[model samples]
Target: MSTDVAALTPAEARARFRDGLHVPTSGWCAGYAQANLIIVPKDYAFDTLLFAQRNPKPCPILGVLDAGETTGPLLRGGDIRTDLPAYTVYRDGELVETVTDLSEHWRDDLVTFIVGCSFTFEAPLLQAGIPIAHIDQGCNVPMYRTSIRCESAGRMAGPMVVSMRPIPATRVSDAVRITSRYPAVHGAPVHVGDPSRIGISDLSRPNFGEPVTVPDGTIPVFWACGVTPQAAVMESRPPIAFGHAPGCMLITDAADTDYLIP
Candidate 1:
């Protein structure tokens, strides 16, 4: 019998991903946290760090692995290059290719930054009776590059990216209150309702990830996304960089409660 993907432990989930099970990670490892990945040469590490510091909403960092290091407290007994379901490679401001593993591209000077992902807070949202449309539809949460620009650091500069979830109008306040408690993982909705206000012309056409259905009476909610770093990478034209494919995050051993306030 096949194991339930949602019920798998963090390590088990990563093991499957390491073995080439490609899938979005929004609803996996329910209570554990999920993180976004960004790898860059050490020469550019300081800029990446500063970028996260300057734009905490969209780039709150969970943990950073030293240059050339992989296994760490957040992801014990695993390789950073292969643990995530999928990875996007970039070169000189252009998305080059995506791969399941980075063994071939690994370099001694590369540093890995694990940024906070909103998916970490989804478990709490579900526990509070807020429905996550992507999870319900078995698809990736919709994400788009917003007109809001992040506070840049050194060569790191780009527009902010956001992930969208449709919340029932009746529960929008509850959704905001619940998520506001976890600032480390994108605290609250950046924009609620009206996608065009943020420069997103169509909900059906997302810059990244798959679009989810917005049920009637539900208002669209947008959260700062960790993919904001990848947007910077693209804008800055760093010679080389790597990031987790949107919605395909790294399932960390850390509990979601670690980021929960109160």
Candidate 2:
């Protein structure tokens, strides 16, 4: 809940992340777009890319890196290996560890992919007079794994993931119209109201991220989450894979407006 971190510019924020400030990227660089990170061996790059292509709502590809590359030009000077606050390492479908830096994990055959995060749209929502419960509560957005399955792409396939926000029932349409402007991000609610309809039995406990208070007169809104890639990793079980821990997105230099649809 530090306003100091939230006030930093994208470059300054990334400088801290590079210097070892391991934390979630929410509410930082308020007008900039944040992204989810995923790295896989080149051998599985195609399958991962295909998975993203087939399921853009849950896995919108923001940028992709060639084998062995760490810097991504499309992200406005962000470094793929060190920009994110924390990374989750998986080996043969099992989570092995969560680390802050990827320098030691770097390999010549690794390819990195950046996925659009809903954080990019939060700024606009706030500006548009929509309430974001998690931001107001100063916590990471709640995310859940749903029974809804993603289309298979070679070895990449799994259940779709979603991030939830509590919206005032009166403003649900405004939330949808404003967020739908950014297709590069998740771009709008995939589900609303009851969590059980999407297979989420508990709203108090999320599969990833912290749960928030849903006050009276508010309805739950869900958007396809960037963490969907992790579900794919669990099912695809690539020999090796790496991704950003939920809420710990890569703060990019790109403006939030950059992704807005005209």
Candidate 3:
């Protein structure tokens, strides 16, 4: 397997996952849009949609599938149950298991929400010469559960989750300006510098994903994470919910340029 992951099309990458390639999808299919997944029973669908509506930064929805519908515009012919590299299953708010496929867990009344992912903007960030530590380190980006709570929507209420990247002191502004153009994919940094201010006491350990090396001259920058829905599921605990494992996004057929604004 000497394939270049970044060069593969979204369909090809998804095919690999369907065949059991389980891995975090941060840097794969470099020029395409990626998405976070959140599935809930039809009973909680409205509450979940309202949650995303109330919190756009972390839950910017790309496309939604009807109850029991698997494929849609964002996915083309792909099946949500088997397309992503990994899936996180939550049982009554408790993370039960992580799996490569969701075939066994399928339900007739389930609705899937495809949320925009920060990885969609990483290409532009790299083009602008802003280093993304996790990609360079070949690991999952660090994600932390912050002290800040998101605006509540019905039974969906929980703390905001954030993904961190160490930006050099000099290019922090450049990173912000470049990313702000892509609001659909989490836009700019929410909180820059001093992770402690947001209740992250240790950079070495993250609540989700692997921590990266933060150089001496680099300042840790955070963007609202798509993982916030998973947090909501944890706190609110609907009967059962499904999400892409943090950083293991569903690579969409849409081009990254589609989300960019002038």
Candidate 4:
């Protein structure tokens, strides 16, 4: 007999993470907002924020925590240092380490920013009767670094990264309509039909996450991914920076409906 892990509320889920749970918690914490996290020293905060603002398609700004503050005032009461399941620490653009907790490296001059995530838009896609192949296969969403260039901000600039889903041609418009309501979380499809159009030469391989099958009658659809910030930060080669590991997002108390602006 198999026992299912108990579902966790947003606050409880965050507490579980702080208590040393480093696993992906996306499907577990339903209905709440899940975000891509970025942490950088105060010196680079302005430049990073500008980078996100300028490339809103890939780096949608959700909530920014002040330097020395761990909790997000606008998003939730959650602690930034502990709420995330896993964190990737980068030194001079190279991934030096990954840790479950950031308390040891926490600094008074460090600031935290939570960007919108595609997970926020997935709910509506499923609701609209579209099938998410990767979710069905229990694998991570496929992500790619495109030839697309993001507008530079100071020293922060790099190629746009995108998350892909194979949707049936008939339902592509439905996917677009459902996701369009949530602009803050990379709304709409960037490219459809041809992967080569966006510089993705192969469909079976991706730079990040596992690739899913592109079944018959289905076409690959792309969206601006939160991972774009991670790529940009790496190119900028900051002395030290932190980001949530791909697929392991920071769950917030905010509802997806709240993100839809009229």
Candidate 5:
């Protein structure tokens, strides 16, 4: 059986991730927000920040680290280079390797960006009595690259990426309402209902994360995803980039409620 992840504190979660436990962060640290990691060479940092600003929905930046720094004030001393359970290294737009730590790959001129993750909204949805299928199934939420293109920022330009969940038709509105309050965490559904409308042919096959069952009477709901930046990396073909493995996020000290809008 899997551990009781939902009950772990942010520190405990980071410890587990740093210790080589590659677990999906869907329901961990229930009231805290999980963040996507992006490490870019100093030369590409400005364009990357611009890319995020232009595409806030898919790339809501929560915190950024100074060049060569491994910790952020809001991340509770967690090392950006090793706190995430797994990381993907991209070399000129191609995935090079997935590793547990960046000690060997760390650079003095690299900057880290922490982007808000959709996982932040999962807890609120469950609190409102909505079921997150992937959590129950012990899998990562399914994600896909859409035909929709993101606005260009310098060398960063590519199609948008989205994460999908199956929400019962009756609770779709509630899910939207709950998520909308957290704009810093990829707010609201970008698309609801037909997957084909967004150029997603098969729900079973996702560009990232795992697919979950879409029960009867439930419709597929899509949200802007942090993976959008990874797609941009592929398009822009930056010399090198580092990002968290899909579903393996950095659990931050910040609370999810900090992102809720009045």
Candidate 6:
């Protein structure tokens, strides 16, 4: 049986998100930009911001919240405390729990940062006739940690993480051309063809997300993923860190078109 798509206005979607909803958010609240979120203590905020700026490919900076502030009025005027559907809380670099609300754990010295996600580019890829295998199969895109190193910032250094999509060899160039327009959301392909060249030994076993089919005529293409920041956070093992649960993103007021520069 087919599932009904959730009908949520932008406001309603934000409200649902804040209430701690952790379900996959794709195809819901269309036309809005979905973002990856990262929250850290005030002491580490500057270093994290610097890390994001230094490694824009995998950690595009979207919006930042001042220490102790939960509402990002400049970006969405939505309450960060309760706007996202789900959150992952980490302590000393370990994932302690995943929750819907941050009210109880909210601290006066906390700062929030939103990162650009590849979901922003998916709409355009579909529009251009590129098939996203995971979307077609109803699964999350496959992600892997690579040997590629990210520029270090304080305690935020780690290997880059990337998301993979299989594309017809004939359409590989087209996918790159279309996505390159939106550099903020990890534009263009990082590697196409051999997965092992990037240290991904097995396509069937991804570090995060599910693997999708790669038909005989298709090749696997990789892109910098927002998960890179989370991985960095994990490696850094800060006292406390928060991130949007995988596949659960912050639907923002920004239009996808705004990201296209050319």
List candidate 6 stretches off by more than 4 Å.
1-8, 74-77
Tens digit of lDDT per residue, candidate 5, span 1-262?
Answer: 1347778889888888888898788888878889998889999999999999999999999999989999977777688888888999999999999999999999999999999999999889988999898987778899999999999999999999999999989999999999999999999989999889999999999999988988998989999999899999988999999999999998999999999998
Clashing pairs in 1: none
lDDT of 6 by residue, 64-144 (tens): 888998777534577787777788899998889988888899999999998888888887788788888887887877889
Better of 1 and 4 by TM-score: 1
Q: Tens digits of per-residue lDDT for model 1 on 44-130?
A: 999999999999999999999999998899988988989999999999979989999999999999999999999988888888998
Worst 10 residues of 4 by lDDT: 1-10
Residue 223 accuracy (lDDT) in model 3: 96
The stretch of ten residues in a row with the least summed lDDT in candidate 3 is 1-10
Over the full model, what C-alpha lDDT does candidate 3 score relative to the true structure? Answer: 0.93
lDDT of 2 by residue, 1-262 (tens): 3578768888888888888988778788888899998899999999999999999999999888999988866555767788878899999989999988888989999999999999999888888888888878878889999999999999898999999999999999999999999989999889989999999999999999999999899999999999999988988899899999899998887889999998
Overall local distance difference test of candidate 4 = 0.84
Report per-prediction Cα RMSD to one decimal: 1.5, 1.3, 1.3, 2.3, 1.2, 2.1
Off by over 4 Å in 4: 1-7, 74-77
Tell me the TM-score of each prediction against the true structure.
Answer: 0.98, 0.96, 0.98, 0.93, 0.98, 0.93
Show pairs that collide, candidate 4.
none
Candidate 3 structure quality by residue, lDDT tens digits, 1-262? 1139989999999999999998888778888999999999999999999999999999999999999998998888999999998999999999999999999999999999999999999988888888889988989999999998999999999999999999999999999999899999999889999899999999899999998989889999999999999999999999899999888889999999999998
Could you give candidate 4's per-residue lDDT for residues 1-262 as a string of tens digits? 0013224577887888889887665465556677898899999999999999999999998888889998865436777888888999999999898899899999999998899998877767777789888877777788999989999999899999999999998999889888888889998878887888889998788987788888888889999999898999889999999999888888888887878766
Of the two candidates 4 and 5, the one with more favorable lDDT, higher being better, is 5
> Model 6, residue 197: displacement in angstroms?
1.2
Better of 1 and 6 by lDDT: 1
